[model samples]
Target: MFQASKVAIVGLAFGAFLAPAFAAPAQEAVDRTFERIAAGVSRAGLEPVVDIDHARLAAEAGVEMPPSRVQLFSDAAVNSALLAQDLSTGLDLPFRALTYAGADAVQVSYTSADFLKRRYGLDDTEALAAFDAALAPALDGLDGVEPVPVPTEGLADGYGILTLQSAHDVPETVARLRAIVNAQSDTVWFGEVDFTAEAAALGVDLPPAVLLLFGGPAPGGVAMAKFPSIGVDAFCQKLFVHAAPEGGSVVLFNSIVALAELHYGTSAPPHAMLDERLTATFAKALE
Candidate 1:
């Protein structure tokens, strides 16, 4: 398990913008996404890392930058060593924006187990199991959302997950997450979900949102200083069950690099936007 974690980190760099593919999102749309993601994050209660230049954030979101501002963006991208230092300190996942390119809205993420536990004081593994207890009622309130079979794949370190997504409101999904997270206040607010082009392209028009769901349940209470390869069951609980607004089915993989490559063709893990990690090329897929 530990060795697997090592391998994931070892291949950190991905080649720069190989495809020049595009997803054009309006600036207002990008702002709304930032607000939604930030609010969801705030509710989760994880501490923020240092802020990068918001202006650069705008640039990543596809804004035109002045010549002076170009340096700002480049400097922000290159000077992202703070996060690498954080990761080296044993923090498994960091919650923050990676790059908010127009239609290509992306952020740094972790499993529900790690992200939620660290945000709130819910560290005990039982805290995760508590969601199972809450699932029945919370899900009942979810209109248009349907539950389907969960897919499980046997992996050396953890089991892979497959499940049909529910069609639910973005805020409602956040509410459901709050029910599971259980650390949120009585009233919680989520930002407007910005749907990704990929989700839309698939006929799944889920609200654009980031839900760091557990495929199953996390082991709980492990120190961030230790990079423990989460067990198979643990990974299952961390699997994201993204509810497509209409018919969009988004599969949340354990590795974001896979999602980035699969969804946007970016060879590098979105983490590259966070630090000086090595960039990786896509492994050729064989049918």
Candidate 2:
């Protein structure tokens, strides 16, 4: 696990010192790289799964904000193979790229498959290696982009994670999560994706895994307002329900506070409360 507080803070401080030297060229490269990445992914036969233009959205809403965007793209076949290796990898799919105008330069970045393999403790080499290879075309020529370093063992420690033993099966747990979100006045059901079904269609064996995304305007808007970059982590919290190796179902979610800290280098009161509410909602759904 990456040390969220220390490493991230220190890295920023160090980066600040070098910001002046890299300013102009970095920003120009970032703009060019974003266009290159979009074209590259399409050329690679991957479709854009999600595209959030943070700058445009803020502008339309009459808010002045720094430029930023988050785009996710992936090929169905490639993703199926990755899911077969470890269902948890679904959280990082369908391949996200984050671009933002930094103090010195516009920056473009994404989590690497190698980094994720280590973070998730995935051991399916053939699948992961293939997944990594598939990403090359999209990332190939980015001048300054690099994946964040990942720890070698266990799950990524920086995330706030909650694992619950479910009394129901995977499908039922998913249904319960959806119903719970629907029942909440402050939350709205965003969507759900089934990695298990996708992998099974490819003749790749995988335990049932479903990702449930949900959150509403108020909490989401607040977090994004506090730190626009928080859109990468807090826009919609995801609850994953999957078959445990031991024969039961398990439910898990990334902690909003931890994600905020990881991405923004600080914590917010609203995010903490939102995390508690989401944790409670999942606990109740499982019960």
Candidate 3:
């Protein structure tokens, strides 16, 4: 492991220094990755672009020892997620990222930051720290925004998915999400929010929101029989539906990677640096 003494010094040297470089390139990478994956899936066939069916994916991957479907999905991708060989495409960027190799030859899975630090090796990884520094700007600033109501974004019959990487802090991420929901409700049920406990055997805390998905128009009526999160590990990924009567939109507060921090989702920068590979992942998710 490499010591990121330099990043620490940089953080200390510029407590208030602002630079244009402080941006969240991870988000862009995610966007692109998802888009391309979506395309790949489409080219492959007609269905979800990437990663779907939380319970089934886990069961096939062997993560069904405990908890329920909700918990299964939440923990599946967020903190203690499991994935099949097929849906495991890796993400690249300045997200607090932790990943696992899925059964799928081409797919790579993700986890949260706290989970990564407490269980995985991202905390002291020099390359990982550099990744975070590169993606810090896009993840910072959760101190002063007033919680506003979410405006609803109408759902079009032609629906497309926008998966996030999450910021870092959970509470702040939730708060920011609450603000977004309040501002927009027509599109509620903001994606999925997976939570995990420990995956020491495999390494790392469990990917946060790797499967936590949010969608629009009344829970999307998706039957998630095993979805369970409360008190399991203080790990939860419940869907907060935000909508008036006619319209609303669902948008994650930040990259799910950022939200993986749990209570500290927006506190620090990201763990994984935004690279072309990660950027490619983001693009694939949308395809």
Candidate 4:
């Protein structure tokens, strides 16, 4: 096992983003380390959903970046509990771990449970504990890697998330969003997750929720080209459609502007045109 004793849990005065990193063996490459982590997740009995190669995606757009990949795994039981507590958590669902080549060593990172609780206002302490405990084995035997803190510089405080009220119900809202994405020449359809059905398969009841995963590779490559770390979490765009208590559905997604600031520490992230396109797309979906 790696140096577990060196692992430190620290916080900041502002809303701290809990990103814990683990270092690979000295001789291990990023891809090898990635495989190791994936094998560990399987050993822990978690289902591997998808593995995104951000570096390759950037190369497809004629941009060069370090070897970086983000693999998403699923523990239906834990995810069901989180969604049962708050459907909004679906925005960050199906747990993701980022494996990237750092300046000196290869590292694997993921958003910590503490950050999830603060981000979604989750009050279920037991659920949060269960989440941490479940993923612990996948990260075992790796030494801790910490990031240098940077100032937010008065960026938007909304955590890069945008929520809109949809005039249609959940399924229709998803359909509309899907239509809009399909119509856009620049965007590509990735996949979709029906959270309600997923939970039902596990015999856990959850509210109506569906997560849409899609992205415009051109824009994504542009962002990753400039800020390689964005590939860690923001490569694939997500639109979460869930039933709203007030009748219509609610659509939620991440804004690249906010993501650039929060994740990459870009003081003046260049995301105007991309944000405009996204705004118009979602506006049409909601309408």
- lDDT of every predicted structure (CA atoms): 0.26, 0.62, 0.26, 0.68
Residue 138 of model 2 has an lDDT of: 80
Rate residue 280 of model 4 by lDDT. Answer: 84
lDDT of 1 by residue, 64-173 (tens): 22100000001111112211222111122222232223223332222333333333334345534442332222222223223221121211222222233434543454
Question: What digit string (tens of lDDT, one per residue) describes model 3 on residues 1-287?
Answer: 11111211121232232222222232233233333433433453322211222222223333331111111111222222322111221121112211111122112222233232332223335433433333333222323212111111331211112233433344344455544533434332323322222233346443322223232221211111121111111112222212112323122222222322332222222212212223343333322
Q: How accurate locally is residue 274 in candidate 3, as Cα lDDT from 0 to 100?
A: 17
Off by over 4 Å in 3: 1-170, 198-204, 207-212, 218-287
* Residue 244's lDDT in candidate 2: 83
Per-model TM against the reference: 0.25, 0.71, 0.21, 0.81
The candidate scoring highest on TM-score is 4
In candidate 3, where is summed lDDT lowest over 10 consecutive residues? 65-74
**Candidate 3 versus the native: TM-score?**
0.21
Clashes of each: 26, 1, 118, 0
| lDDT of predicted model 1 | 0.26
Arrange candidates by lDDT, descending. 4, 2, 1, 3
Highest lDDT against the true fold, candidate: 4
Off by over 4 Å in 2: 1-36, 53-67, 140-159, 184-188, 246-248
> How far off is residue 111 in model 1, in Å?
3.5
Ranking by TM-score: 4, 2, 1, 3
Residue-level error in angstroms, candidate 2, position 85: 3.2
Query: In candidate 1, what residue range of length 10 has the lowest lDDT sum?
Result: 66-75
